[model samples]
Target: MDSLQPILNSIQKFQQQHSQILREASRVAMISNYIPDEAFRMAKATENLTRQLKIINSDSIQKAFDTISSIKLDLHLPSFPKFDYLEFDEQRLERITRHNVSVGWTLTGDMPINLYLRDEYLDMEHDEIDKIFIAFYEEDEYVQLKTLIKNVKNGLSEKWSEILDQSLDLYLEGRYKITIPALISVIEGELSSIIGSSKYGKRLVDEFHNKLDDKMKFLTIAAYSAYFFFDEHLFKSHDFTHARLPLLNRNWILHGRDDPSAWKKEDALRLLNTLSTLQFIKEIEIAEN
Candidate 1:
């Protein structure tokens, strides 16, 4: 028995560390946005924007952004898909995306988190697309996230305003444990509201099936990720274990089984952005109906 003392102590310590979780059998988990050279990623994202800093007045990119931003769904339902349309200059998109992919980054579209708002620029003529791209990708505490918050602040549903504002503050303060759980919860809540269904977890992914177009850039991006949250064995589908590595597993987080150590800024930020995209879809739905 004495020989097993050290092993027992290790197990005890682990359980003690997560006592709060055991108590709850419960609880929850975003990014305000990554780490391990988060600074480098921010700098690189900004620098990479320079690599393709070419925008033409009335280019398709600009047109799509303008249309999506202001299109009134009721009046423009037939034309909605037209305005929503965007094409990528394959080479340019590849350049922009490849680097981001290398860093484990992806635009949160369908889930529409990508800068390719049909998803940039250098010294040529800058326009709204450039601004949005930066807003979507920049990891800087100093970026347009504040502007995003401010612009939408007055417009958010009261329930959302509370959760989002508090989560954002926690994320910015590097309190991933608090922010991550709340974002995960609110994200699920918002999705339930969006789909007008009570479906939860992987069930939510099924709700999106009929709603997606696959051809529309933003819709596809946003919805693809919503599915991702519960699909592809990220969570729920897998059996739970304390030894499992954390990688944005919704089940583990919600069950209070995930280690906060693995919940990085990326998790919080991505979910926040996902919530933002979901809000956009919900607003569009309200307008159309």
Candidate 2:
């Protein structure tokens, strides 16, 4: 399993904070002599804050569980044991008062009433929870890749926005095959908008080549190299002449030439990154012109 230390450490920190807050609340209730209503209000406020932390902890656990479960189901592996969030019991404070009395030649003490509140608490197997998170992170490379796509999408123009969003949504929903083609559409649309209609493939490359001097020629070639390399690598099938090309085999996805059952998360991620890079170059070119 990949290191989930960051998330696990965060959970531990929250747990420690929760414990400290509960202890503070208990101490406040014990030492304070505020009116009954005021004390109750203060206690309730502490309880509310404690409840919010509990919710955050539970949400983190649930996200880890769901990510692991999805991977297990997809790979036909045995599922991890299901676990539930720990629920804390409600808290209440009781007020008490003490008095002393003297009789004849002797002094006596009455029962000293005690004021206290139950500490907020919940318990779980920290090791087991950590294991779940570890498993999720081990197989969760797609999430990191999706974040890359999202960052790139943030800079995209309004024309490509909807398709970029749709592609991301499809990827997250496990529709891996569909997302590849959808992302390819984003690349196609953006390039067409930049280069104008009736010009793509070799023609677009030539246009850049024609417009550059010797010094700028390498930049133009480098830009075209990225454009053609990604397109052919991710979106095209190998021809006899192009057998050495890196093949993501997205042509199968786009043309329905074969079943998309072989599509993997990495394939979609690579395509998104490739398309994002191409769009970024195109944006620069548009600005320069």
Candidate 3:
């Protein structure tokens, strides 16, 4: 169910170009040239070109079928024009060309073989094919989300795996009510693990805050002043308030006071991203140590 649009587009472009060439060749074969050998040469070239074109057309059709089949979607493709008539016509041309090329070239009885080309078959099926690609694009997003969750889970301790798995499973199953809380639990679990670690604990937080302050001070005076104002009114105040408020501090979700209906998919995703960030930071710390 991966994207088939690229392949489909390529096939369409090839068909358009091929059809144009076939039309020109057919026109040339029909022209009554004064030079008899020249007419035979054009006929011979057109016959060989048509044969090659038919093979290319057939192969492209087979490719489209193969791609559709691989996705496991039950889509019916429209019937393509029969190549049997074209093959028979090509064989007749082959005989004509062989006779003309070997002996004296005969331009008297030569006729233009009308090559069958249908562009409408693809046009009719284009919408259905596009729908399949749309579905595949959604499926691909879900797959990528799952992969990110899996990577974050792997970076965590074994105890947090259940929380991560349960949250994702519920999310996928459309149980958003339960999925939000489960995701919240995963975030809390990862945060607790990091803060409760004997080697890193609250001391790491203190060091991180100090480093952040030092970095902020090194900015230009105007930038530092703006950040200082933000720090006092927004960042530090929010941190202090968040630390004091039980519900805002994750107490309600942890203690089962938050409404499930109020939670959203974006909230869950943001929490998951935070957990992923924490996991990345932990890995960096481990590497440094």
lDDT of 3 at 116: 20
Q: Which structure among the candidates has the greatest lDDT? A: 1
List model 1 lDDT by residue over 112-174, tens digit each.
222332333222233333344445545476354554454344444576677667766775677
Off by over 4 Å in 2: 1-147, 200-225, 235-246, 249-252
For each candidate in turn, give its C-alpha RMSD to the true structure in angstroms. 21.1, 27.0, 27.1
Q: Per-candidate TM vs. native?
A: 0.52, 0.40, 0.37
| TM-score winner between candidates 2 and 3 | 2
- Could you give candidate 3's per-residue lDDT for residues 79-149 as a string of tens digits? 33233334434344444333321211111101112212222223434334323322422365576457657
Which has the better lDDT: candidate 1, or candidate 3? 1
| Angstrom error at residue 17, model 2 | 33
Between prediction 2 and prediction 3, the one with superior lDDT is: 2
Of candidates 2 and 1, the better by lDDT: 1
Q: What is the overall TM-score of model 1 with all chains considered together?
A: 0.52
lDDT of 1: 0.46
